[model samples]
Target chain A: MSIDWQPFLLTLQLALATTLILFVIGIPLAAFLAFTRFRFKAIPEAIIGLPLVLPPSVLGFYLLLLLSPASVFGHWLDTWFNVRLLFTFWGLVAGSVIYSLPFMVQPVQAGLQSLPLSLRHASYTLGKSRWQTFIHVLLPNIKPSLITGIVLSFAHTIGEFGLVLMIGGNLPGKTQTASIAIYDEVESLNYATAHVYAAILLLFSFAILLLVYSIRKKLQGSITGL
Target chain B: MIRINITKQLRLAHENTQLSIGTTIPSNTITAIYGPSGAGKTTLLKILAGLVQPEQGAVEVNGRIWLDTARRVCLPPQQRSIGFVFQEYALFPHMTVQQNLQFAAGKNGDKSYIDKLLHLVKMEAFIHAKPSQLSGGQQQRIALIRALVRKPQLLLLDEPLSALDDAMRHELRTELYHIQQQLQITTLLVSHDISEVYTLASNLIHLEHGKVVFQGEPQQLFGAASLSSTLQLTGEVLQVIPDGAIYTVEVLTGKNIIRVTAGEHDIAKLQTGDKVCLFVKAYTIALKKMNG
Candidate 1:
């Protein structure tokens, strides 16, 4: 039996895109959460943490309603930007980003919080701007956390099932992620294809986790040793 | 001269303390902010550096207005031209000794000036070493030079030598004294050690419960108390050993830890870590000039 590679490639592309976007947005958000003393900080914190506990389907349902053409937001997007999110690959990315946000943010936020306040203060006193300090001083010191956030976001996006199923219906090459393809194959009694996909995913996830653990161990050892 | 008139409300662990300080410090001199714990010493330093904001105040450093609450003008730390050495040294662990100074020296920082600073501290040998690889004393020296690399108008040190052992503290204290003199930059040092204040500071601002209780020469605050004695030393009580009716109290003063004989009343009020002043009558001490 010949296997189709389209879904796997699409899944990799979606995961890469999602992880990149999250990395760009997540650092500033995590820094804000870690450093801000706003009175209503808990509100934003709770919102970011919602994905960690909420079932993927619950988030997917709201995202579906929010992005569907029947909704005002969806219509606004379709009209102004001429962008259609529903049942699209980008829609799958949007959903995965939201679903995996806490995974990226929590580790990064914890890392920022764990750093000594003096590091930032020292940089500031030495004529470094806040942006400079954040980029040069703060970010370099929290490498492990950054690695963890990136890896977790990538792996979580790759393993996505329920959210992808909801927002990005199984539409062949356009929207069918590897997990979705696996589901489709199993439903069609294609056990061999399903087994192949499942085994690949299992091995890939194991490798990613192993890489994360090893890198984290090395980083932690160096940090403490220093 | 630096003129500071500021008042801030501080919420400490046990109580709400108000820090009200108004003092003039001599320019280009090491002025020690001597105070007990919870005296808002570090906070005052931070305020001058523009790191901490005062509720109401004006800080004029060498005729430059750094902060004016009424005018709603407060220079950010980056614009203040100040170098602050934290108590913990706060050297960047990721950067080597050279890089830490380079980062402080800024985009247009002179390479020769950085080299001069490293050489001045005798840290040229460890230029490529990261902060983690160096000992606490080495890191402290790097931190001190890093603050000075910018040639800041004001230098603030928050107990820079507090983390070092006695021997290292003494050695660095002397090094810091020479560096300050050579640079002639205005410096504000926060120190709880009376001996440290006595040895390094030319001017003293004594704070108690966040208020400037005294402002004058270190000699005026610590020296004037014993006019009859030629040598006066202050130290913290390390241990109190009793033998017969007299008590032998070990006091850590400057570079030497000497045991003093105390009477019953003296031993009664004394505790470990209590600051004590020792007045040695001129006859009991010998003085000699060493040939260079």
Candidate 2:
């Protein structure tokens, strides 16, 4: 039986979109969580970290309810913005982003926190603004964490099954990612096709993890040399 | 002139301490904040640099209001136009020496000034080197020049030479003095080394438990003049050789190993590693060349 490339392509697209969006939003969120001091910081921290512990199906179930047309937010979006998020490619992307948020955030936050406070203070004393310091000094120094965040977010999104199942619901060419395609093949007794999908994912994940580890080793060496 | 009167509540490892200080640092002079560990010397420097906010205070540098609690005006470190060399140097590890200095220099920063500063420290050859590649002394020199790149009105050094070995420290101390003299910038130095304060600072603020116990000339504070015709020196005791009634005590003071005679009463409490104050009568002390 010939393998359909559509699911793999859709998975790549979703992973890329989710990883890009997460990268854009995650750095600032991580910086805030790492640097800011407030009375209720743990509340937001806990909320962001919920996906790490919450079952993917449970999280997906709540997300499905939140994005359904019957919900106020979904109804508001449908009426005002004319945008639908449920069972769409964008919906899958959103679900993946939420599902893999802590994967991106925790590493970046830990990296930022591990840095010396004087590095930021020194930049400030030299008349560098907060944004400049963050972009030029702080971010550059935490290269390993940034890599980990990006790679983990991408890989996690690609490997996602339960959340996509709950939200995207195997809509071929729209949201049926490789993981879902593999599940469909298994249920339909297409063991050969399922083997193809699972093998490719396993290899892809290993390569990504190997890249992260090697890059981390090199960065750590350079940092210690410094 | 920099006039500062600030109070901060510091939470240290074991207990909380209040840092209450009021002092005027004359412009174009090096003023040393002499204190024991955990006396809030570093905190005071940070306060002046706008890195640490005091509970209540006013910092007027050259008549520019840096911080005034009454008016709720606290300028951030960016607007303060001050140079601060942290104890760890705080050089950006990712950047080259040239980039670090250029970053501090800003858009209008003079390229020649960067070259000149490097030349002054004899680190021009290593301009393209990163901070990690440099030795402790080299990193410190870069840190010093980086601080001066913007031509700041106030220069704050928090134990800038504390990390160096004795020889490096001495070399850098002289280099620091020359640089400070050449620029004539108003500087606040936090140092526990008495010899450093004596050699470099014109004014001294002696802090204890985060309070200014004394503020005056280093000589005035350290010079024990109550006993007229007496010379005072602080040193660590190295050995106590008992030669009958009188004990020959060897003290390591500054770079010198001086031997003084003490009686049984003085030798009773003294040990190998005890810090002691040596008081010599003016008439009894003599100056002689090493060769002679």
Q: Give the TM-score of candidate 1.
A: 0.90
lDDT digits (tens) for residues A40-102 of candidate 2: 999999999999899899999999999998999999989999989999999998899999999
Worst 10 residues of 1 chain A by lDDT: A217-226
| Residue pairs in candidate 1 whose N, alpha carbon or C atoms collide under 3 angstroms | none
Question: Which lDDT tens digits does candidate 1 get at residues A68-174?
Answer: 88899999999999999999988988898899998899999999999999999999999899999999999989999999999999999998889999899999999
Give the best candidate by lDDT: 2
TM-score of candidate 2 to 2 decimals: 0.91
Q: Model 2 Cα displacement at B251 (Å)?
A: 9.5
Model 2, B6-54: lDDT tens digits are 9999999988999998889999999999999999999999999999999
**TM-score, first chain, each model:** 0.96, 0.97
Which regions of candidate 1 are displaced past 4 Å? A220-226, B225-292
Cα-lDDT of candidate 2: 0.93
User: Least lDDT summed over 10 consecutive residues: which range in candidate 1 chain B?
Assistant: B278-287
